[model samples]
Target: MATLLHQITIDAPASRIWEMLTSRLGLQAWWDGTVSIAGGDCWRLSSDDLESPVTLKVVEEEPDKSLEWLCVQGDPDWENTLVLWTLEKAKRGFTIRLEHRDWRLSEIDLAAENTRWGERLMKLRLQCHHNDDLPVNDDDLSVWT
Candidate 1:
């Protein structure tokens, strides 16, 4: 099994970051997809970038602290994987750490997956900062388009 980790510090409240992680609307603002509650503690994420919708089941949630989701449906490589997000309060804001774990080493392009997660975290940082006025470079836009 393989694990990919990324961390970013954003100058925002933990409560706000927690909301972004837990709410569909807040997720849509940063995540590159159309997010909707599938049912119960599951979320269905669909995007043109994805071959199919990925269904994530919330396995653990600690308000303003951490959240974990298990990939119940999606690409074969992603199935059974775990996505974990942990937030720690910092002096100016919060440090968010993400772990995408339990991957089959033979099934994935580790470098690409790592880059994708890193970019998404940057998007989350920008969203939390309310940087709607800030310009996103073409290279960044190309990733989601």
Candidate 2:
């Protein structure tokens, strides 16, 4: 199994970022397509442009400190993977450390996934910084394969 990691510093407090991470509306702002809370710390993420219903279960949460999820169902390539977000105070605001672990895919797919996360994290930062909700438009790297 392989692990993919990404780190970004956003100009926002940890608490504020935490809200974006836990709330449905906040998720929709940064995530692709619609996000709905499916009860009991579970989330149903579906995109109109896409067909799969990604099921994410909150396995662990620590308020403004950390959030972890296990992909219980959805894309076969992503199933059983662990997604974690760790936030800490930085010189300016807060640093978001992201991790995607338990990758069982080809190296090419792994690289694409890394690029995808980089784009997603940038979108999250933009949403927090300039209040921009639009998705990141990176034509060169596509995560929707």
Worst 10 residues of 1 by lDDT: 136-145
RMSD of each: 7.6, 8.0
> Which residue runs does candidate 1 get wrong by more than 4 Å?
105-108, 131-145
| TM-score, every prediction | 0.85, 0.84
Model 1, span 1-145: residue lDDT tens: 8999999999987877876777776678788989877776788887765678899999888788988999999867688999999999887899999999998855447877787789889989888888343243332221112
TM-score of model 1 (CA atoms): 0.85
Clashes of 1: 0
lDDT of 2 by residue, 1-145 (tens): 9999999999987766876787765676688778876666778787643347778899888888998999898877778999999999999999999999999989998998898789879988887885544344342111111
